[model samples]
Target: MSEVTERRAAGSPADQRLPLLQLLLVGFQHVLLMYGGAVAVPLIVGQAAGLSRDEIAFLINADLLVAGIATVVQSLGIGPVGIRMPVMMGASFAAVGSMVAMAGMPGVGIDGIFGATIAAGFFGMLIAPFMSRIVRFFPPLVTGTVITSIGMCLFPVAINWAGGGKGAAHFGALEYLFLSSLVLAAILLVNRFLKGFWTNVSVLIGMLLGYIVASAMGMVDLSGMDARPLFEVVTPLHFGAPSFHLAPVLSMCLVVLIIFVESTGMFLALGKITGDEICPKRLRRGLLCDATASFFAGFMNTFTHSSFAQNIGLVQMTGVRSRFVTVAAGGFLILLSLLPKAAYVVASIPPAVLGGAGIAMFGMVAASGIRILHEVDIVDRRNQLLVAVSIGMGMVPVVRPDFFAALPAWMEPITHSGIAMTAIWAVLLNLLFNILGERGRDALCGHH
Candidate 1:
C-alpha cells in the first residue's frame, strides 16, 4: 500500500486535533457554509404552512437547534450513533415536497408533518443497517457518478445565488454577478498564493471580503434585526402535539430512504477525501445518527435531518479533515439557535457572497468524484456505458426537474433529487453490467 493509504488505514485524519483558534475559525466556516441550507427547509415549510412571522421564526430556531445537536452527535459520536467524521447535519430538502403536501391536507397540518417525521425517523433507524449494505454496490464507477451528480445538482443553486438568489427583487443583476465572481477570485488567489492554515481558511477569508464589500454596497439586509428577540429557547411541540396519519408517515418514510441513499454517497465522498475507509459499521452508525436526529427533530419542530452535501465540498477545498472542527461548528449552531440576533446576522450575508464560495466548493465535490473515477477501468466499453448512462440519468433532475413531473407523486422523492437518481441508476447499472455479468461469466467458465 502507498504511504498515504497506509497512514489513512492507521487512522482517519478527521480524528486529528487542531488548535483552539483554528477549530473555532474552521468550525465557524462550516456553520456559515451550510447555514442557508440549514434553515431553508424551515423557511419553505413555514411559509407554506401559513405560519405567523413569529411562528416561522420559531421554526427556524428549532431547526437550527436540532441541526446543531445532530452535527455534534455525528462528529463526536455517542456509542453507535455518530459516524465520527466531519459531517454537518441539516434539515433535508428531500422532505420539503412531502411536508408541504401534508401541510395542505385538511386534517394533516404541521402537527401531522411532525408526526410523520417522527415515525420516519424511527423507521430509518431500524433500516439503517440494511441501508448501509448498499455501500457495497457503490464501487468507484458508481460513487464517482453519484458524487459528480451531487455537484451538478448543486450548480443551479450556486447560479441562483450568483444571480442574487431565486425570487430576489434584483435577480440576475450585474452587481450580484460581480460580487460572486470577486469572492470566487479571492478564494482562488488565497488558495494559490498562501500556505498551510491561510490556504485552508481561504473560503472563509474570501467570504469575509465579499461580505464587507456587499455591506459597503448596502446589500446586506439587517432590517428586522431589532424586531427579533435577543434570546430564546426552542420549545418542542411548538406547533402543538403531533398527530400521525398513515399517508404522511409513509411519504416521510420514503423521504428518509432517499436521505439514506444520498447520505451514503456523501459519507463515501468524505471517506475518499479524508482517506478514511468507511467500513459498513461506520456507515450504519452515521445513518443511525441521521435517523435519531430526524426523530428528535419532529418534536423540535423541524423536518428530517441529513448530512449537508455542500460541506462535503468545503472539506475537499479546505483540506481540514478534523471532525472536532465540526464539533465546534455544532457549538456555534446551538449558540445561533438560542441567540436569534446572532442567527440573523449570519443570515443577512447576501446570497451573492455565498454563491461565489459555492462555485468553488461545489465544483470541488465534482472534481473529487472525477479523481476517484480516474482509478476505474474507464477504458472498458461496459464501464464507459455504466458511467455515461448513470450520469445522464442523474442529470435529468438537475437539467429538468419537471421531467419526472408526470411520474406518480409517490416517486417524487426519488425523481426530484439528482443525487438520489444517480445513486439508483448507478447501483442498478453496476449490478447489471458488473456484478451479475461477472457472475455469469464465471458460471459459464465453470460449465466449460
Candidate 2:
C-alpha cells in the first residue's frame, strides 16, 4: 500500500491528541464553521410561525443545546448510537421548507412541526438498521454527484451572506463584498504559508481578521450584545406539547428519508477520506445517531437533526480526522447553548465574514466530490451522463428556487431541496443505466 493509504488505514491523524488549549481552539473553530447552518432551521421556522423575537431567540438557543448534545453523542457514541467519527450533528436543511409550511398551517403552527419531527425521528430510528441494505446503490458516481449538487445548492446562501444577507437594507453593498473578499483572501494566504495546526485553523483566522477590519470601519454594531442574558436553560416543550397531525408527520417522515440518504453518502465519503471500512453495521450506527438526535431535538424544542456536511468538508480540508476534535466542539456548543451571552458573541460575527469562510469550506465539499469522481470510470458514457444530468437537476433549485412554486405544497420538501432532488435522480439513474442493466444482461445471457 502507498504510505498515505497505509497511514489512513492504520489510523487517521484525528486519533492523535494536541494540547488542551489547542484542542479547544481547534474544536471551537469547527463549531464556528457550522454555527450558521446549525441555527438557520430555527430562524426559518420561527419566522414562519410569526413568533416574537424572544421566542425566536429561544428557538436558536434550543437548537444550539440539542445540536451540542447530538454532536457529542455522535462523536463519543452511546450504546448503539454514534458512528464514532468526526461527525458534527445539526438541524437538517432538508426539513426547513416542510417545517415552515407546517408552521403556517391552521392550528398546527410550531407544535405540529415538532410533533411531526418527533414522529419522524422514531420512524428513522426504526428504519435505520435497514439503511445499509441500500448502500450498494451508491457507487462513487452516485455519491459524488449528490455531494457536488449539495455544494452547488448552498452557493446561493453564501452569496446572500456576502451580499449582506437576503433582506439587508444595503444588500449587495460594496462594503460587504470587500469584507468577504478580504476574509477569503486571508484564509487562502494562511493555508498556503502556514504549517501544522495553524494551517488547519485558517478559516477561523480569516474570519477573525475580517471581524477586526469590520470593527475598525465601524461597520459592526456591538450594542445588541449588551442585551443578551449571561445564562439560560433550554426548557423542554418550550412551544408547548406537540400536537401530532398526519400531514406534518408525513412531511417530516419524508424529510427523515432524505436525511437518511444524505447521511449515508456523508458516512461513505468520510469512510473513504479517513481510510476506514464502511460496512453495513457501521452505517447503521451513524444513521441511528441521526435519528436519535432528531428524536431528542423534538423534546428539546428543536427541529430534526442530521450530520452536517459542512463539517465533513472541514475535516477533509484540515486533514484533521480526529473524532475528539468534534467531541471538544460539542463541549463548546453545549457551553454556548447554555450561555446565551457567548452564543450571541459568536452569532454577532458579520455575515460577510462568514461568507468569506463559507466560500472556501463549501467549495471544498464540491472538490471532495470531484476527488471521489476520479475513482469512477468517467470515460464511460453512462457515468458521464449520470454526473452531468444529476448536477444539472440539482442546480435547478439553487438557480431558481421558485421553479417548483407552482407545485403542490406537499411537494415542498422534495422539490425545494437541491440535495434531495439530486440524490433521487442520481440513484435511480445509476440503477437504471448501470446496476439493473447489468443484471438484465446477465439474465439474458444465462437464458441463452
Candidate 3:
C-alpha cells in the first residue's frame, strides 16, 4: 500500500514499468513462482533434524513468515538492510548442509547451534559492507559464468519436480501433470484473456483452482487445518534455544558470506534487467537487509535468506519491476506464517505441480544467464572455458553428492553446495583468466 514514486528508468520494459494492476499480478505471480522453494528448506531441514511431521509443518510455516518479512526488507529496505529493488527473498539452499550439520533434535540437543545461527546471521550483516567489494568484480566473465552456473546448478531441482518427485510411489503420475498443467494453464490463460488485476492475480487464481481440483479429486490433506489453532503466533526461539558451537557457527558464517556472494550476482542481474540504480551503495544496503532477514530467520529457527531465484523469471515474464508488488507478497507471507491453517493448505500442493513450475522458472533463469553471455566475447575461448568449468564445478555435487564425501567434515559445508562452489570457482577463474585484478574493477559486470 506504500506509494512508490512513479519514476521510471529508460530502457525499463513495459511490464517492468507497468501500472499498479499489472504489477500486482506480476508480484503474485512471483509468490507462486517461489512458494515451493521457500517452504522446502524447512521441510528438508526439519526432517534431517528429526522433527516429526507436525513439527516440520510448523517449521515450514515459520520459514515462510520470516522469508516474507525478509523479502520486504530486500525490496523496500531500510538504512542498509534492503536492496530496495524488486527482489524476492527465500531460504538459501546454501545453508542446507550447514543446517543439517547442526542437526538440532527435539530434546537433549545442541542448543549452541541455534544460538550460533542467530549470532552468525547478525555477524554476516555486519560484514556486508566488505562484501560489497564483490560487485566490482562481476564483469562479463565472472558475472556471466556465475549467473549461468546458477541456472545450471538449479536445473536439477526442476527435473526432479518433473519426475513426480524423488521416491514417489509412481513416477510421472497423471495427477501431477494435470495439476501442473492446470496452474501453468491458469497463468497462460489469464495473460491471454485478462488485463491488469485479474491478469496479475492469475497465478494465485491458478493455484487456487488447482488446489480445488486437486482437493475435489482427493489430492489434498486438510487434516492439519482441523487440528490447527485459530491463530498461531510465531514466538522467538519457538524451537530449541540458540546453540553457539564454534564449529557449527563458523560453518554457518561461511554459508552466510557465500550467500552474499551469490546474492551479489543475482541483485546485479535484477538491477540490470529492471533498470534499477542498484549501484555499489544500494547493493550494500540491499545485502545488509538480506543478511538481517537471514539473521532473523535463524533467530526464528530457519535457514539463510536470499532473493528467490525463481522470481527473476517472474519479473522477466511480467515486466513489473516495481518492488511494491514484492512488498505485497511479503505481507501475504507474513500472514501465512501467522495462520497455521493457511500454511497447511499451501503445504498440500503436489510435488509434480511444483516440479512443472520449477522447470519453467529455473529454465528462464538459465536462459537469462546465457543471454548475458551473448554480450561476452565467446570467441575468446577463455570465456567459453570459463562457462564450461564453472558450470561443471557447480554440477559436481548434483552429479555426485558423494564426490567430496571422503574429504574432512569441515569441507562438507562448501562441497555440498553446487552454487557456492560454482560461484567461488567462477570468480576466481574469471579473475585469473579474464582480467588483471584491479581495485575499482567492473570487468565482470553483468551485460547491461
Candidate 4:
C-alpha cells in the first residue's frame, strides 16, 4: 500500500479494528445507507426503456451484482485500481440524463446506453491520471457549489417518491403522505435519542418500522409479485449486444467527465474526514477503480458506476472508517445479488418508505457541501458571486425542467443534470474570477 501522509493515527477510529460481529453489523449499516441510491439508476433506466416488470427486476439484480463487485474492488485494493479507502461504489445518478436520452432515441435503447457507458468508461480511465492533476481546480468554492447542486437536483426525485411516485393513480394520496411522515419521524426520533451504532442505523430502523406499519395499513402488498428463482447467475449482454452510436457515446462521455469532477470533491472530502492527504497517485487509482467498474458494469448489464457520496456521510456519522467494513458490505451485496428472491424483497420496499430516508440522506449531502463552504471567505465579493451564480445556474433544471426545451436535443444531457451544470459553471467562474485574475493569482503566490 502506498504510504499516505496525514492519514489517521494508528489507534484512530479509522484504523481501529473491531470484533467480527461489530464489523458485520456496521457494514450492513453502510449498505443500508446507500441501498436506495444504488438501486435507483437501474430502475429509472429500465423503466425509461419500456422494459417489462420482469426485465426491470432482472436489471435490479444485475445492478446489485455489479455494484457488489465494484464496492469490493474499491474498498479492497486490487493491483492499480482500488483506493483502499472506506468508499462504496454504485451506479451514478449523473448518467441518468444521458442514458434516458439514449433510451428514448430511435433505433437506440438499453443496448445503446450500455454501449455508451462502456466507451465512456474507457475514456475516463485513459484520462484518470490527467484528471487527478487538476485537483486544485476544485477549491472549496467550486466543490461546495457542485455538491450542493447535486443534492438539490436529487431533492425533486425524493419529493416525487414521497407523493407516491411519478404517474401513480393515487399520487399525493393522504395515505402516502402519512406513511412518509411516519417514517421520517421515526428516523429523526431514533437519531435524536440513540447513541453510537443505533444512531448510525437510524435509517434502517425507520424503514423497518415504516414497512410494518404500511403492511398493517394494507399499503404493502406482494400478492401480484412475480416469483423469482432462489438462486440465479448474472449473465453478460443479457439484453443483447450493445449498439454503438456517436451522439449517445459523446453525451455519456461528457457525463463521465462530470462524474470525475464530482468524485474529486468526494475523495478530497473523505481525505479530510480521515485526515489523509489526497495525492495525485491515490486520486488516479481511485478514479481508475470508478472507470474500470463502469466498464465492467456494461458487460454485467448495468449502467455507469461511481463512488456513492452518501456513504461519506455514513463514515462521518459512525466514526468507523475501516475499509474492511465496506468490504463486508460488498460481500453482503454479492450474497443478495445471487439470491434473486432476497433482492426482490429489498426491491419491494415502497418508494414512499424510501422517501423518508431519502430526504435525510440527500439532505446530509447538501449539508456537507455547506460545511465545506463555511471554511471559505464568504465576505469576498468574487467568492460570493461565484457561489451565488453557480448555484443559480445549477437550480435551473430543478426549478424549471423545460427552461431549455427550445434548445436542440443534444443540449438535454447537460441541461437535464443540475450537478453537471453546476460543476461546469463553478469551475469556469472560479477560473475567471479567482485563479486567472491578478489579485487572486497574487494571493495564491503570497504576494499580498
Best by TM-score: 1
Clashing residue pairs in candidate 2, if any? 14-321, 14-322
The candidate scoring highest on lDDT is 1
Superposition error at 156 for model 3 (Å): 1.8
* 2 versus 3: better lDDT goes to: 2
**Could you give candidate 2's per-residue lDDT for residues 1-448 as a string of tens digits?**
7433464577666456667876777788899888988877888889999998889889999998888989998887887788878898998998988887787789998888888989999999999999867776777778778877767776777788888887678998999999999999998999988898788788788989999998898777767666778889999998889889998999889889888988887887787667676677778889999998898789889999999887877788777778888999998888998888788878878888888888887888888888878877788787789888888888888888899999897777678778878888998888777767865443222120
Q: Give residue 13's error in model 4 in angstroms.
A: 4.7
Candidate 3 per-residue lDDT over residues 160-260, each given as its tens digit: 76566786677777777777777778767887998866755655676677767877888776764798876887777877677667767787788788778
| Superposition error at 323 for model 2 (Å) | 1.0
Query: Candidate 2 regions off by >4 Å?
Result: 1-9, 439-448
User: Considering lDDT, where higher is better, how would the candidates rank from best to worst?
Assistant: 1, 2, 4, 3
| Residue range 257-301, candidate 4, lDDT tens digits | 878877877887677666666678888999999999888788889
**RMSD, candidate 2, Å:** 3.9
Cα-based lDDT for every prediction: 0.90, 0.83, 0.72, 0.79
TM-score of 1: 0.96
For model 1, what is the alpha-carbon lDDT of residue 124?
100
Per-candidate TM-score against the hidden true structure? 0.96, 0.93, 0.87, 0.89
